[model samples]
Target: MLLSDLSLSRRLERAERDSNARFVEARAAVSPDVGAGWIDVGGTYAMFDGVESPCTQTFGFGLFTAPSSGDLDTIERFYAQRSAPVFHEVSPIADPAHLELLASRGYRPIEFTSVLYRSLDGDLAIAAPADSVARPFQGRVRIVDADEVERWAQTSAAGWSDVPGVGPFLVDLMRVAAVRPDARLFLAEIGGRAVAAGALTIDDGVALLAGASTIPDARHRGAQLALLSARLAYASQHGCDLAMMGALPGSGSQRNAERNGFRIAYTRTKWQLSAGTRA
Candidate 1:
């Protein structure tokens, strides 16, 4: 019931479950260290950053309910009571009536995110363009720990430096993710210094490539490709049937993913709740 053709239903199932798992794992990530938690509002999962620090999705919801199900009022009350930045990811396969309902209820489109996926039947090679500008490093990547978590976080922050006020959040998320049983943080190191990083979460026969970043100093030397290859290998070994990731449409990230054999599953919208609108 998700995509126009039933041929994609299984893939959509993977994507939906992968997306749902994030909120669940994120809620668990904040449980012991921070008091924040996740709440299921009429089948939708909501996450709140527990420590309340400026870093981190700190608070938001995903895996939205169908508008035809008549849960609009419940969803509205859930966000109306939260008092934090409310966000929703509406998939391209989502019911247009549902989107209409959300828009009618004051949700405004803010951003576009493309979900890409690739089957994990092995054979994922790093994207190495002959005209690559960055220097090829003599370093290797591995699962990280110790001070490496901090380094991974710093690299991620640098990768996303263009975003204002994202450093702290990336740091906290990486720190927490490093300890999650479902999560694995991978780092590419050259000369014993962590340069590029990516995060993977495995659950229910699928792995989500949650985040990938490299510092400006290590942009082009195939760091992300390395991360992707490694993560895919690990996921396949760990029984992950499919691997998925999200990126900005028309961005370099999207191009990189496509070059690595990831197919476009869909483009989704991140909708924000407009001010002064009643549920």
Candidate 2:
């Protein structure tokens, strides 16, 4: 990662933060339990959705910013106040002071995800599997409709079966994305069946590519690449300078994203609050 792209790096971090906040806020519109308003924990922004189904990392805590060491106890109390875990991400661009404070308070690293980006200066290659040479998913990346929200949520949930009970949250989030300014929800389909879903969130000319998911039967096909190509084209057409996404580093998902032109900017670490610090 180039140090000169600090602006891009920070935006990428905020892209993750702001989009998720939007989801939590948007989700509240469709379901009371899914989206609660956001709050700031010390210096970090906290998204509250009230659901205990999955990790609260995405919805509750902002990355790259940490509470002051003096406020560490207070933040822990805040999470404890809600009976929520003190989960948040620490990225390369985050304030070093934050990580130091987290470490002192017994936070343990739990997850790692690579932040990737590519300039949208030109057209992207739509790479598909050879056996599926018919290119069935091409021209199938359409903007999602409100009625298709459930389908989008279903595909996302099934795509990540390891994380149970997240379908409703994902669906409600997309429902809000459909109407938000500069936010676009997309899906790829064949024969009227939705095969994949992705979201484009543009901020200050940088488009954040998120919520990419494909069903089990649709795996190994170019559904994702097709969605990528469509989103890239759409973002570029709308004057976004670059596009960004995240994936687990060294995982096949990272390789796929790299093949599609995204390069790692940095990998952020998700830290879990140790039980000892609950209150």
Candidate 3:
């Protein structure tokens, strides 16, 4: 019975912030030529993976500490120097003045994410998929061994192959993620063939679930549910008190999170600097 108050928001946001920062650190360690980097500003983490990498952004802004104008200036400069757009995933529980300041500086809301959480007070019962097609999932989930990093990354990228673009980028990104020290990569296999993948990162007693993907041929076969159950169990065994994730509002991911006992803690907005503002 955890309350969705500011304290909870801080824990959830910090868990995710630390996870993203770890990816940045891992990327830098694995490929320093890519210029992967991150900095902490007034309790906020500003990361720069690439000009177009989704990892390029800020987190925990105005949450741990009220962000001042000078703080914003430094964060903006950090990204500008890297030729990346400034983006901030802002939680609703953050200082209200933060939004006003962002808007005043020409930052516009570009995306929204429903942050969800569920307590891990005891052994979590694995929830069956809602649809009959995915019930009694016939797959098994297991953590990847050190030698299987490439296979894990390939399985993760295969899940996104249908997209018109971004396949190669995802392959590289997942490869880096597979080696992230803070992350545990899980693979769902049916008949001994990997079909799905997901990642879990625990920080300060909170587990952040992310990188969920199922190959096109593997959908509706219960792979995701198997992965979810495995990840949750792993988190609980690791002494995490809660698990959190984010999904687009009204999306199937959100529905799945809800079906698995997660509740919306807040809807966070991702603000991006307008082109004019950047100029």
C-alpha lDDT score of every prediction, in listed order: 0.65, 0.69, 0.91
- lDDT by residue (tens digit), candidate 3, 10-103: 9999989989999999999999997999999998999999888999999999999997888899998998888888999999999999988998
Best model per TM-score: 3
Superposing all C-alpha atoms, what RMSD in Å does each candidate have to the true structure? 4.1, 3.5, 1.3
Lowest summed-lDDT stretch of 10 residues in model 1?
A: 53-62
What lDDT tens digits, residue by residue, belong to model 2 across residues 33-112? 54365666543555566636332453223234445654555556656666777777767666666667777778889888
List runs of model 3 lying over 4 Å from the truth. none
**Which regions of candidate 2 fall more than 4 Å away from where they truly are?**
1-5, 33-35, 41-43, 51-55, 58-67, 128-139, 160-182
Per-prediction TM-score to the true structure, in the order listed? 0.81, 0.83, 0.97
Q: lDDT score, residue 28, model 1?
A: 62
Tell me which of candidates 1 and 3 scores higher on TM-score.
3
Off by over 4 Å in 1: 1-35, 50-65, 68-70, 130-137, 146-148, 162-164
Q: Model 3, poorest ten-residue lDDT window?
A: 126-135
Native-vs-model 3 lDDT? Answer: 0.91
